[model samples]
Target: MSSRQTEVMPNFEQTLLKKRGSALTDGLSFIAYGAQAIANDEFSKCFAPKPRNKVISYLLKGLKAPLSIAGMGIRYFLLLPIRIFILFGASAGFFIALPIVLRLKSERLKRLLFKLYCKAFLWSWGSKIRYHGKKPVLDEPHIFVSNHTSIIDYIVLSSHGFPHATVAQRQGGIIGYFQKNILKLNGSLNFDRSQKNDRSVIAQKMREHVFNTEKSPLLIFPEGTCVNNEYTVLFHKGAFELGAKVAPVAIKYDKSWADAYWHSRTQTFSSQ
Candidate 1:
């Protein structure tokens, strides 16, 4: 009985081994077919043409250069007339409004109008003001000193929310007429620098404005005339002797884009 049992066990083990070998062979054949399919798919993609969206992207990139330039040209021609109108309109409106502002006795209204005019004038030129350090004192009268760079410096100072008047030297002709009228309307003082007695007269006038009057602060570009922004000339001593509180002010502007310096020899006031 033991021998017959041993013979049956050997036949059963042999059948199990044959089944396992057949399963392993079938699995390897399936893996080889799958790998071949993957390789063929990747190879086809390498030769395929680019996608429709990619082609359109290249086309738009080629057009961007010319399209951007055309857009800028269109914008300039469209806005040119408006800028010119604003410049002339602001100039005319300034002169027209000056007389009315001057006649008003209210100091508050005068300052408000003058500030508005300065802002409008600067806006027409697309100028931007960047202020630094202490501002002008309003409670008590003080001498406001700054370096002279351009006639536009006064306009920029006027926009500083102070009703201060500027000290200017006398001029002649139509230029002088407009200048005197505008400065006088703002209650600014002008003196003849060529005259020997003018200094005494100016000193007395400044003393009265500082000590006697109850108005805005007095502003003076002590250098007298416009300097090359790089260096300053000697300052006049009239503003210093008033014995009042002195506030030193510095004014700077972007000279690269809109240089306001009017040297008279090279640049005219209107040109600046």
Candidate 2:
């Protein structure tokens, strides 16, 4: 090879090696951080198996085990088919009515349909929602921010009332199709973080959406990621940057029934 080719190849190999090394370092750091968190019982409290104790806890577990097994069996054999039926039935109804809803001029009807659809899906998932506090007025131009624990957070919020717009990451497959269509109807924004300047573009759009009186309030999860409900992480300030009244919505899960946390780094949405 020529001298120029030889020099360029070495530089290219060096750059590739550097990137691999950096990735390895990041992976190690993440593992170390997770290990530290687990050691502190932070992870265990949220995700790890139930803590074993010598007396009351063990007795409680022993008592609960048979009931738990029975419950699981009943759920898998009986409730599972019912839930599946409801889910598909609801989805079919939504899509079937969507075309007719679009042809109508009544925004109220559209919003009502959306809310009902969300409620149906949540019900299929065996979600027992206990919404507290006064519901926000649908006409107001406010920023509704909430803590996000799982993929179902949006569904739960939308069931109460449809936001004019919501910020969500672009997704793929059947989920992506539903997300795109639902958000399109609401004039919501979907962003690809991997794209250049996407955040700034979405931010500008959000500002416009918040100030427009004709549009209803926008919903945002400032956390920007799912966290186990036991603790919170630092929130992104983008939601606050918009010149609109920021209403905080607190969501807590009853861990006795189920854990809603989605560890995205280690699990896919479907798996979770």
Candidate 3:
């Protein structure tokens, strides 16, 4: 009788809404296509620790997601050269057009532009970083520190431009040259850990960059080496000595180390 009445008086929107709203009687959810679909696709398996077939399907979807990432290896390799040309072009263009441009450079607008540049740089390599911590509103300046697991940390920090700085290291190839200029342009202090006297000089420079002015937060990677999924490496005191209070941050992800291959536990573990 209920089925017959539903069929005769079908309220398609209401009917779909109900179907999309709940878990299944078997303690699982019904999976369907579309945004906010008739069901949630990923549900826990019953009577077992591992996922059921439905869960497996959802996991597979996640695994194949990185194949969906359009560019990574090629773009990352080409990024520095491209940016170098871009920098040159923009600099020349800005100087030539400075008289003609009319938009007032507001302090608020400059900050917004800085944020946009940071986010674009981060996404260029097809890598995404998920952060877990209390995101500071940063009414004032402060230092940031993280585990140097990958070379992408600079982009992560660049997204926040409040006159912040980080320690600089040697350039290997393209990224090194591109990054050296980027950091220099942004006022980063170069630190050569291999040198004895250079260490003090570097620290003094960092202290000045962070403390001598309005006191922007210092960003440092306590673990000097990028961890290979092991526990954090021993922290160095150089970054902390500048009288900046520590704001410890941890970045962990299943797919990040792989960079672009967003799915599959096998690749995930390899990245870790």
Candidate 4:
């Protein structure tokens, strides 16, 4: 091919590439963000659209009726109820059980319940996830910080079902009594960020969770408070200072945080 033809070929291909990437952006960005994996690619990974290799396209390629029925039946009969039960259990534990029973103060329960709560949310709410492209992995137990839009971030990260500390601001003593109590029982390290000198002690504990002994991934929302998903706020240094890789997950919610405030009336991430 001539040099002129070479230049012309790239322009034609690039034009098609731009169109495909752009079309997906406007509609899919606000959903579960399976497409965000395309955006989540790191430095060594360059942006390249494969005409036949898009993630979602592949999932729907040849899926037949039998498998589709099995998927729904499984999710409803098995996955969803269990998830909902765990969520309600965790919620009750947060509001009723743990508070009445002081022994629930244990951090193990906190972490465990958080995982169950997250699992429930993902299985029940977030649809059957099919990666059309790349996906995020919990390589090491780092403080995973996200823009606090919905309580779902916890469930979203937790659905992956990894162990880690989840810190909350102990504003109304609500956290200390219920939220902190159950979260600790669930294998979480709970620290009230507002308490004086809590950072140093919590830092040591967090470092322990991140480095010493962890069965799963720890999650943190360092915006310090939940906000609208319209924009991402500045992250708190606690997550980064703990020496864990900060996995910045931008949860594009179908609705606003204000629309679904379960954990806190204003602050603290409570159990769903």
TM-score of each: 0.66, 0.74, 0.51, 0.48
Question: Which residue pairs show backbone clashes in model 1?
Answer: none
In angstroms, the error of model 4 at 62 is 38
lDDT of 3 by residue, 152-179 (tens): 5655665654424567665456556645
Q: Candidates' lDDT values, in order?
A: 0.68, 0.75, 0.51, 0.55
Q: Give a tens-digit lDDT track for model 4, residues 104-199.
A: 565456555555655655544544433233335555756566677554556565655454556665534544564554466544665565576887
Clashes of 1: 0
**Which window of ten consecutive residues has the lowest lDDT sum in model 2?**
1-10
User: Of 1 and 3, which scores higher on TM-score?
Assistant: 1
Sequence-dependent TM-score of model 2 = 0.74
- Please name the candidate that would achieve the greatest TM-score relative to the true structure: 2
Off by over 4 Å in 3: 1-114, 137-141, 160-163, 213-216, 256-272
**Model 4: residues >4 Å from true position, as ranges?**
1-117, 121-141, 161-163, 171-178, 256-258, 261-272
Per-residue error (Å), model 4, residue 168: 1.4
Candidate rank order under lDDT:
2, 1, 4, 3
- At residue 190, candidate 2 shows an lDDT of 90
In candidate 2 the C-alpha lDDT for residue 226 amounts to: 77
The collision pairs in model 2 are: none
Candidate 2 per-residue C-alpha lDDT over 125-168 given as tens digits, one digit per residue, 9 for 90 to 100: 88888889887774556788988888788788889856346788
